[model samples]
Target: MNRATLLTLGVTMLAPLGSAYAADDVKVVEKPIRVLAGIFSAASGANKQRTAIGVGYDFMKTAATNPTVYGVFLDYNSKKVAGVTTSLTGVGISGRFYLESANAAGKPYATLGVGSYTLKAGTSQSKIGGKLGIGYELNNGWLGELSSTMIQKIGGKDPGGVTFGIGYRF
Candidate 1:
């Protein structure tokens, strides 16, 4: 009889502790502003490599497996690709979906972005383009990603290349 009473008391005491742990598995956020700034290393379709700096912010969040973010950013790429002199100024809307567990180690995410850009290659011309990439979010509030962006109407070429970036989520 005494053993049964102790077992019942122990179970009652541990149940609430287990429940508290479950609640901590998810991040409790009350509206967050996401911001990131990173440098882009790109290889254009013209077989040229260029570098650019980009900054972005996400103003909306949707609940699914985790928090999904959507916002906009600006990018500027140098015009020195494959010995061709040119530059690109771009502005676009971006979206990211976070998949996996969100914790101190953060999670993995995929991104999609669309924008309009002006290419300066002797003459200034405008085009519509987009970017796609995959990245990992670190627990230290930093992000690392590899992306590809494409532009239209530059020497009959598509300027899409891989970009490696490191930034922050705030």
Candidate 2:
């Protein structure tokens, strides 16, 4: 099976877990205002290259005493090709788990999630990945993050690779 198919299958297998969150209260939130742009390197076996620019957004969510955050994000990327170029577009749900720091300042965090990726190779796919980042919270309810991810490709022609971006928490 190809990556997209595997993703769909995996999500299908995990459909029951969605019900667990039903007991939790659902709330709407907005986050701090910030943006980040950076470059990412990707390698499949031995062929590797770096993309010149990668972009991401941070939509801050409600910050409790524990300072958890939730938001939506989108990312775009491109790969060099001889005649035509290949590209990837990803959109998914994102969140952060914070570690309380000394002095009551913004804390460090780690995040992970799955999303869909549209590739130029004729198939749009869904992928699962994990990320780790360091973040700081300013006095004004603003949070900034720098993180990286390695998405697993189940069915695409290319093996999954790494992505880097920034985030914000309100």
Candidate 3:
């Protein structure tokens, strides 16, 4: 037990892993990016179809863990069928789960989304939707939103809709 006392107990256990690489080295803070659009509708109450226009995007955050918002959305859904003059184009990939309460400051917050629609005579559809909405954030960085999306078309028998939207968040 005396090889210089086992080399002084392995240099006192490697001096706490060499003082953890001299500590202080970890600083990363970068969060600034948000974009949104407006106008969307797909509705039916015994064929009372209401479809609108104007849509937008630019929102990317794969996973957020503090008031849930997991995202990847670049969406555009259009419609114009005023009497069979047919017009429909939906190109999308959308997924969102939302909840944000900033201690009730200028209130309104609740969102839930799911989308997969590709229809420009290419017939590919999937949308299981949700939206019970209210949103307000105006401190010059305008974010005024009102949402609703209740879609069900996962195989083709397309007749399910409820989308009312207004958005602007940059």
Best by TM-score: 1
Encode model 3's per-residue lDDT on 99-167: one tens digit a residue.
Answer: 444333443445443344443323444443333345565434456665554444444444334444444
Off by over 4 Å in 3: 1-66, 69-78, 81-101, 107-114, 120-164, 167-170
Candidates in order, TM-scores: namely: 0.67, 0.57, 0.24
Better of 2 and 3 by lDDT: 2
- lDDT on C-alpha atoms for all candidate structures: 0.63, 0.50, 0.40
How many steric overlaps are in each model, in order?
A: 1, 7, 0
Which structure is stronger by TM-score: 1 or 2?
1
User: Lowest-scoring 10 consecutive residues by lDDT in candidate 2?
Assistant: 45-54
- Model 1 residue 62 lDDT? 50
lDDT of 2 by residue, 89-138 (tens): 66665565566632375566665445665555444565554434566665
- The residue pairs in collision within model 3 are none
* Worst 10 contiguous positions by lDDT, candidate 1: 1-10
| Clash-forming residue pairs, model 2 | 2-155, 3-154, 3-155, 30-60, 31-60, 32-170, 106-137
Candidate 2 Cα misplacement greater than 4 A, ranges? 1-34, 45-47, 52-63, 101-105, 121-159, 166-170
All models, RMSD in angstroms: 16.9, 5.9, 19.8
List the candidate numbers ranked by TM-score, top first: 1, 2, 3
